[model samples]
Target: MKDYMGYSIEGRTTAISTILNQYSSGITLMKQDSNGEFYPLKAKTTILPNGSKSYILTPCNQ
Candidate 1:
């Protein structure tokens, strides 16, 4: 076991969960912490053209 503290933590330890449930629906968003990590959101969903659905997730401004 090595030192696991602060920003030194790996992905699982440092991952951040930022989700948009209302708009995203089945989709989820994972945000990285200051250290730059990753975590699973949840799942992806596709909507039919006839269905009244819109993607809450959009391109990042930055």
Candidate 2:
């Protein structure tokens, strides 16, 4: 596991639900690859079928 800005992250892929459950909304999420490079996930706020809120992360065009 690695710590980034006080957030404990484990594994290469993490579920968006896990992040939203932990940090709530309006928080930017960053992903670190095996090479130790940080990348921003283009987070889009979404509402689930149950009406819960979460974020969907996609690769940034840049």
Candidate 3:
């Protein structure tokens, strides 16, 4: 989420889409809070029961 908040991926291996999905609505993709700060969603792609990739949003945007 820190990387997303900064908008600078200095050392990022996970895809932006993945991170977004992991965080879900808890974190904003490009929206700012009342404090005018970006809390990026921490999303990731996981293997589904059907042998497919599915996005899983984490409990929090951490």
Candidate 4:
């Protein structure tokens, strides 16, 4: 699956379409802190299954 920044998560990937099926709204923007913890930037964020935290991306205007 790919995020807004065009980063791809390969190998046994869960389709973003499938996720959207469950959450027709949108994907959550997450960030990892220096201590290695994931947190959402918005309150209305989607909680991904499997609790995977590998796909977090830095927010960008482009």
Best by TM-score: 3
Q: lDDT ranking from best to worst?
A: 2, 3, 4, 1
Ten contiguous residues with the weakest lDDT in model 3 = 5-14
For model 4, state the Cα shift of residue 33 in Å: 0.4
lDDT of 3 by residue, 1-62 (tens): 44433444521323554654555635344535688776554445667798976544442435
TM-score of each: 0.21, 0.32, 0.35, 0.28
Alpha-carbon RMSD, each predicted model: 13.0, 8.3, 9.4, 12.1
Candidate 2 structure quality by residue, lDDT tens digits, 1-62: 11321243422233553464457677656777888888766545678899976554465546
Q: Is candidate 1 or candidate 4 better by TM-score?
A: 4
TM-score of 1: 0.21
Candidate 1 residue spans exceeding 4 A from truth? 1-20, 39-62
Model 4 agreement with the true structure over 1-62: per-residue lDDT tens digits: 45532445521123443454346567754556788877643222345687744433223321
Best-matching candidate per lDDT: 2
lDDT of 1 by residue, 8-57 (tens): 33322322222244345465455565667754443223465897432222
Clashes of each: 0, 0, 7, 0
TM-score computed on alpha carbons, candidate 4: 0.28
In model 3, state the lDDT of residue 9: 56
The model with the greater lDDT, 2 or 4, is: 2
